[model samples]
Target chain A: MEKTIIVNAKSKTYNIEIIDHGLKKLREKVQTVWSPRKVAVITDENVGPLYANQVQRQLNAGGFVVEVLTVPAGESSKSWMNLEKIIQQLAEKHFGRQDGILALGGGVVGDLAGLAASIYLRGIALIQLPTSLLAQVDSSVGGKTAIDLAAGKNLVGTFYQPDLVLIDPTVLLTLKSRCLVEGYGEIVKCAALVGGDFWQLTGQIKSPQAIMRNANALIEASVRFKAQIVAADETETRRRQLLNLGHTLGHAVEQAAGGRLFHGEAVAIGLYQLSRLFEQKKLTAVGVTEQISTRLQAVGLPLSDDELGTTDFYRALKHDKKIKQQQLTMIYLKKIGQPEFYCYPIKQVIGWLQQELSQKKS
Target chain B: MEKTIIVNAKSKTYNIEIIDHGLKKLREKVQTVWSPRKVAVITDENVGPLYANQVQRQLNAGGFVVEVLTVPAGESSKSWMNLEKIIQQLAEKHFGRQDGILALGGGVVGDLAGLAASIYLRGIALIQLPTSLLAQVDSSVGGKTAIDLAAGKNLVGTFYQPDLVLIDPTVLLTLKSRCLVEGYGEIVKCAALVGGDFWQLTGQIKSPQAIMRNANALIEASVRFKAQIVAADETETRRRQLLNLGHTLGHAVEQAAGGRLFHGEAVAIGLYQLSRLFEQKKLTAVGVTEQISTRLQAVGLPLSDDELGTTDFYRALKHDKKIKQQQLTMIYLKKIGQPEFYCYPIKQVIGWLQQELSQKKS
Candidate 1:
């Protein structure tokens, strides 16, 4: 059975339907929402061949004019060059503001395509069909669409909400084990923030198969927290910072690793590292670190990092957009289910990270 | 004397200050509003040398760290490449979410810089210091930040309002006659939209001197209408679209001219051509054509187009983001003040244009 979650953003309200084989009923689902004269299913090079044809056929069968546009798959495709090309093709196809773009791929493709939809004729309707576990859980729900610059990931973007997000756990059957585990990093973050029952549930999952078995329930809980956080602070001003609990160090480590570390793996290490900081501050109860580590390791996420040492971490933090007036905003766990924010001077943060790194090594 | 007009857009309300020698008091003005720790004055090659140094010095003297970054001047600078460079520089400077970007040039600079501000760290504060007449009167007040794509102009953009818009008409003293006239085209469109006193005022103006002498009143009136329209819609869904009066054909003609015709000049011609269509349909009163013609010609705005013939016009329309499912959404004048929207299929629009083109030639 399919479950639907409604994200009530200020500007627009959209539905996120979590299901099995949702792609097969793509036409019926779209038709139930709104009918457009034309539809463009924008996918990536990898996912396009896998699902683009099926998506196009369904929409076409529903008597809607459908065209599938594909960009090269991977993080690199989320560049302005690809954005330009996709925009050029959309123009050539004579797609108007009233038409729709179905973003059919992973996070990178969804981001690029959703951004194109946001800015195409000021703003248009966008339906995100997130195929990857990472996208299905995280990027797809928020109206935050962006393209990367050389300086940072998601350097250029807008808070443009999508009209719909269709998530199918069955699609995860095709995702690599690494990709699945990477998604769990975000899941763990959500579980920790939610605490209580969700935290208990997260502690039980041990492997990729266990994650798949519980994907529907976990996604619903995670998406509920994300949707609520997004609805409250769609622009990432205050409450939403909780979602970035591990992302502060995670982003730096991921960038420093230069492609060796997956985002979730880096985030896993970030969680472990920050847990130690929490322990020092007495923010979390005793043994919180062990519980987080146990949960992460059970899902095959890394608890230690050999790469991206302290110096690299400091350098990355200096360039982070979150740092204002030499002050960095860091999110920490008050407990497994409760997160809190702290703003520290760069000097103090550097010292803290140095201490953490040296202690870890010893 | 200085005047402040409040633009009450739904998402945010901002002030547009029209003053003489406004740039001289830049520091004082910014200090009154918010004291950003760092200020990045983003300008263009042409305007940067003229004002970037002075702006930076003033802000620096006010005890705020200041940096000036210049992009190559003109419409070409509104490319993805320049956007990437600007983002990189801001990130490298460690400019954070609480910082401010002072957009200190013409429409191109304001657009690119404003867009960069809107997405940097989700968003940063933007203060527009529009230099050109077009920028001051039109692009500055509307919160519409965009970059041109090869497909069409403003194909990628956002409805991100600025925190402040500072208009210094004295800066127009350095602008050329063509630039001055281009601005009048928009002024004419605004005057036509807002009938009565504004229309009479527009009809009275004849020369560049008159425009400069009456700049404050004219800008206030034009900006007032724009602000009201934006307040009601914010996004170009319904009422806001009326602002596109004369822009449909105007954009096509501008592109077809290949830099030969200025944007406002092409818009002036578009106003003229569409008036002719309205007259034929008897949708306009008998003297409407003569009044619009007299006003456009009196202001030295172009009333005829030689660069863009009918064939090129149709081709350009085919690629416009405004066209959906082969239908073109055109904004027309019901009378002097009232405007209406109509969507015409490509076939009908082509025939109408062909007839109008031959009629003009004959």
Candidate 2:
């Protein structure tokens, strides 16, 4: 079965296609929007070994010249050094404005390559082929591309939308059990924000395996919800802040953990912790925290890290790009499916986190 | 007296203010659009020593915490190395989305700082304070931000418009005579493309001194013409390509000259040579080449470089970003003001240049 969700962005409108084995139809789908003389398939070490050859062969069969560029599969690959490397390589290969870049890995490759495509010759065609669940449902669909700076993650980037997005759920069967569960972090977060039918569907799915069993439906729901939000607020001026639901604290937790947890794991913990704090303050609906904790724990996703302390989180927050004029805009729940933006003074936010930490220790 | 021309870009509508000694009103102009807590004034070594302190004081008086970031003065400063340095400094300074970047230099600083502002935190407010004639009349008004790569000039960039543009004609008095004359390359090119009254005004101005004497009128006409072209075609899809009147061969000539020639100087030669060739082929109107040559020579601009060779020009043309699918888009004139696009096979373009070079030698 094939499901297509059209995203209307400020610059262009494109489609996100979800299929059982969409990789097989990659060339045909790409040909609809772009017909480049050459295509650079940017993947990472882990994904390159598994699918790069297959993708290259598929594109070649369609009479397209294809070259695969691989970076080491990790968040570290999303750096200025790698970005320059990719751009220089493309320039050396004589990639023109008519050429295209196919980002064929998870979030790291997607972001690094998307950013390269946006600035190379002032932008060329970019098509996203998201293999990981986190990417398929979230990162790949949105046009937000970035490379991390030493100070923080996504500190340098552009909001460059892709020409098309092709998501193949069949690839999930190749992922490790842990990687599959990590994808649920965003799934669960979206479910919480959307509430209603999406929340009920996600809440009922007890394990990663069951979630994978219904990947098509869940992926479509998440992408559709995100697409609508992005269409209305492409630049994230106001309503898009809601999409950063767990990301504010999630980024802090991820930074504090220092490679110990995946981004989705950090986000899972952020969603749970923030809800608990907001619930205690009567800002969030009663039972929302328990509901999120139950859904996350059921899927074996971590809710907290005993190793991270409040000081580490505070340090990370200090460098966050979201903080403006000594205030941070945080997203909280008015109820399941209903999110609100609240501006908090930096000192007050730190105080709240510190008080919550002390109580946990006691 | 201040003359304001508003540019309506796809992302923003900004005012380009032209006034004598406009530096005195820098803070007042900036305050009209942005109220940032901090503003980073990016300039080059040459421009920094002259106007950086003055700009900082102006912005500071408006309660904006201002810091000056200066790069070396030259075309070489527009490189990946400097781009990284500027971005890293902005990140280190904890510059957020609300912060603004005030580019206080010529083309190099404007391009570099504009690119930095476009991607830093996915974009921040950018104010262009173009101090050079090439910048004030051309680069600054159009919002074509770029930095050079090892492979080519402006190989990596973004089409990011600025929040405001301030042009101070008083700065021209401080420029070297050679530097001041170089600015006419683009001014003359715009006149040829927009022939009617603009061409008449530019044609009558016979020297660098005369052009500067009528700087306000000439700059306003050039900016107004460019602003309309950009507003209609922001991304250089079709109509925008006409603006590259002499740029195709101009870039090759500039690259072959290897820093011996200023960008405008190469463009001046490009305007003369291409028109001569096109006029010979009857593609351009009769006497068009002589008209361009007369205007360029009257302003003390070079019509050709004796040092450059056909092979050197061909080598550079091979790397131009405008060439797509082994074809180059060359702009020609139907008459004085009427420009048209003609795509020629790369081989044909090389053949034409080779023929022209041999004739010159003979």
Candidate 3:
């Protein structure tokens, strides 16, 4: 389904387009809107060296300065120090006012660099070019850009919107198998939540390798699912918060692991734990956990991970950014294709984690 | 002329009232919108010992947790290391999202604490209680919050808007004579660029000592003038940039001077130099230079100070955050009250500065 959602914000109406080859008309569409004099492309070292030259050439041909800024790959680059360095480099290169920043990497780059553009002299133009499946479907579609602190992941960020999102399916062919499988977890969540023909395709995803090898169809479906959600709730005021389904524990696990695990990998383990808990509490159907587990297994993500956290898992939960008023709020799958956030108070989570971790010792 | 302009932002609107007793109504108006549970009042050694008790008592009686967070007063306190300490303090105090941070000192506190608030779990809330006249008129109104880096001043910052501004004119009476006079320089620039009655009022300032003793009327005038400019152009798009009249040279001078000279003092000299440059170039009236000198003299700001950074002035210009495209864009006053920015090619300013410094040495 190629659905379009229009977001109206402060004399600007940006369209969230979800379809294969969405990058085709982007040059024409953006040329009419943005000033093409100076476009600073921010990507990670992994992605930058791969696609920087091609993107720069195209943008330069379009009459843009097209300065390529490469940060080291992974989450560690999204820090105040990195932001300072980027700002200094941008200022040196004269990227300001009329200029725009093209975020051309994964979630970390998009979030941090997008935030940098947002507050650069109080909001510069942002053009998102997501190269990963996770970024294409989730990170790139939404305008929530920021960096992490020692306190937690994405604890410091902004609700900054990008001018346009450029997602090329061609970019997915170059991704790692683990990255593809991790992205597929979100695809499964989205299909289950949105629950339309999108679910049918995801439910029929029998082999993870097969879907990863031919991801154009999966990419299109997943992008539409995310686009519709973000378009309705651009600021994450109400509806968008639900999309954080497995993210609460997932983010904490990732943060605690200190970048050892991928976001999607953590989320898969988090989803499994939450599903089992939901079934135990009678919050979910008897067969729901099995159905989700089967789908996740097909996508090459395990139903259980013994090496997730330590005896201090409960302590790590305290560091989650979603936490407020000592209540552990988490997004859980209500059914195979439905999700919602339920507030599991901190005291109860600590008690549950203590019991679960203690059981391991026995 | 007393004018009240509505600050138009998506969040909320507040009146920028150019009148005495603006502080009294300000509290009531802000309370009507977003009432703070507690007012964590962060002040400096000088400003805190004086007005912190009074403000605390008022807010306490008004039913808000009025804890005072005081620090040593100066630009050195604006550093990242100092900001980290303040953040630690804020965390230990367990200042929740419902509570707001109030900057009761000058620009240093406003910038440092405001940056802390901006990034403390991705922004809480901000209230400006600017004591120094410079902060009261400039940083207080705008959302340009930041902390200084070891590299340069205001190297790390965000454009975070304050929920309320509480400006008590009575507090101005207690300000140091030199400090008060330095602030008057900003008002002089405001008057010169804004023109009309503001310009005429500039002539009325007899001495820095007198200005300090009686600055309520002038403070309101200065604040209201700039407030109107910012209200229309909140993020410094077009007209708001006009407020930076003489800031190019002023910022360089201030940065070079480090903490020895206050912002307003450098601005005073910058304004004087700008006026003189215009007069010399046959761009203005014969007595324009004399008028600027007289106004600054009356305000008790040392326009041609021997203590200023005559040595490291050019070096400071290299760090101007606003510098883009290798051009040093400066805001200069055309007439007594209308200021304009002239983006000079960097080489021109560098050559001229070198020649001027050599002449000064001779």
Candidate 4:
């Protein structure tokens, strides 16, 4: 069965199609949304070797000229040098206003390509071919595209929505077991934010394999939940900040871990640590932390990082883009499925992290 | 005397305030539209020496903490290196979402600063303090912020509208004579598009000094004309292409000149040359070329480039972002004020240019 979730952003509205093997119908699916003479398939070394040739042949069969532009696969590919390279290639190839880009890898390729699409000739048609579970459920559904600066991850980016997003659960089969598990961090985060049937569904899935078996349902739920939140707040002025539940500390932890942790792993740890601290402070309902930890651990997500108390972690936390006027808006759960935001001083946030670290060590 | 032109773009609606010594009221005017705790006045070496401190002091007096960031004063400043530096500086300084950037120089500074402001923290408050006549009348009023690339000019950009635009004609007093005359290229282009009173006023003005004498009225007319067109077509899908009356060939001429011709000077030559060719082909009225030539020369603008027939000009023209699928859209005058768009094959455009060059030689 195929499910289509319509993301109604302020700038544009597009559909996220989730199916068993949507890649087989790539040309037909893309043609329905946007028509371009040429399409640049921007992928990374990892996903490109696996899927780029197939995507090119499919689109070529559909009468679209396809060019596969590959970058080194990893977080490092999302840099200014790669961004400039991609844009310069597009221009040198004479990709016009009517041309399009297909981001056909994980979050890094999606972000770098999406940012390129947004600025090349002031934006062109973009279709997301999210090949990973995390990208399908979180990054691909929203229109946030960015390249990292030395200061922080996603410190520089634009909110340019894609024309269409095609998610195929079968592609997730190719993702390594660790990569697959990392995606569940965001899945659990979404489930926690939208607690009804989704949370129950997440709780029932005991392992990564079981979650993959029910991937379609879980992906649809997460996409729908995010679509609703993004539609209401496209620019993250208020409600959109809810989406950053685990990201505040998650980014800091990720930065501190330096390449040892994937994005979702850090987010998983951030989710657990923040909730535990909130419970201790009497802000979150008692036992909510236990429930979150159980769901996360059931999916094999790490609940804490040993290096969480490092100075690099604190520095990354302070450099978060969410900090406005020395104040940070931290998202906490009053209860499962009920998230609330509170403003704290930077010093206070660091103090809470320190307190959490001491308590965990004790 | 002060005149305010309200621009209603799809992304934002802001006022373009034109007055004598408007820099004196910078803080008061900025407070009306946006509130930022800290303001970064991004200026150029040339303009910084003249007005940065005064603007900083004024904003400081209004309880806004002001920081001045300066770059070299030229088109080269609109480079990836400068863009990266500006963005990194903003991140290092911890500029938040509520913080603002005041672009307080000519088109180069405005373009670079505006691009920085748009991508920093995914966007922040921006106020365009356009000092040059060209910027005040054209680039600053529109939400088109960009940095040039090695492949082409404005290949990377975003349509991010400023919260407000402050244009003080008194700043023109400090502009070099060549710079002041260069601004008249865009001013004439605008008058030619809108026709009627704007065109008549443009014709009545005899020289660069006369333009300065009537700067308020001329600037108001040009800004109002552009504001309406931009409001109608913010993304340049259809009607907004009319604004590029001379820009298609103008950009090519400018690129080929290799910094010898200011943007407006190349545009003036483009305006005259394209009109002459259109007249010879009977696509434009017989007197249209004469009228364009007279106005351009009246303002001491150049109407011809000696390097018009060079391969560099042809290459630049072929690389224009406006070229869509080997087809180019050329804007021409139907009469003094009326403009029309005609799509020609890239080959046909080259042929026309070649024929024009041959005829000039004869």
Rank ordering of all candidates by TM-score, starting from the highest: 2, 4, 1, 3
TM-score for each model? 0.96, 0.99, 0.84, 0.98
Q: TM-score of model 3 relative to the true fold? A: 0.84
Better of 2 and 4 by DockQ: 2
All candidates: TM-score of chain A? 0.97, 0.98, 0.91, 0.98
Per-residue lDDT of model 3, residues B1-362, tens digit only: 33454566444466554445544555554565456575678889998887777777667766777778887888878765666666666655655555678788888899888887777656777777787888877777767776665555665676677776766666677777777777787888887887787678777778776675556667777777766776676666677888777677787777777677888888888888767766776666678789888988775677765533365677767656666666777776666665666787787877876676467657
* Candidate 4 per-residue lDDT over residues B1-362, each given as its tens digit: 88888999988888999879999998899889766588889999999999988998889888888889999989999998999998888888878888999999999999889988888878889999999999999999889989998878888899999989999999999888899999999999999989999999988888889989999998999999999999998999999999899888889989998999999999998899889888988989999889889888887889888778789999999888888889999899988888999999999889978887978877
lDDT against true structure, model 2: 0.89
Q: 3 or 4: which has the higher DockQ? A: 4
Stretches of candidate 4 exceeding 4 Å from the true structure: none
| Residue B90 alpha-carbon offset, candidate 2, angstroms | 1.0
Better of 1 and 3 by lDDT: 1
Can you give the lDDT of residue A76 in candidate 1? 85
**Cα shift from native, residue B40, model 3 (Å):** 4.9
Candidate 1 structure lDDT:
0.84
| Candidate ordering by DockQ (highest first) | 2, 4, 1, 3
- For residues A69-184, could you state the per-residue lDDT of candidate 3 as single tens digits? 88999888988788877877776664556678889898889998887887665567888888888887778776777786665566566777787776676677788878878887
Q: Give Cα distance to truth, residue B155, candidate 3, Å.
A: 3.8
Clashing pairs in 3: A111-A146, A192-A337, B192-B336, B192-B337, B193-B337, B193-B338, B246-B331
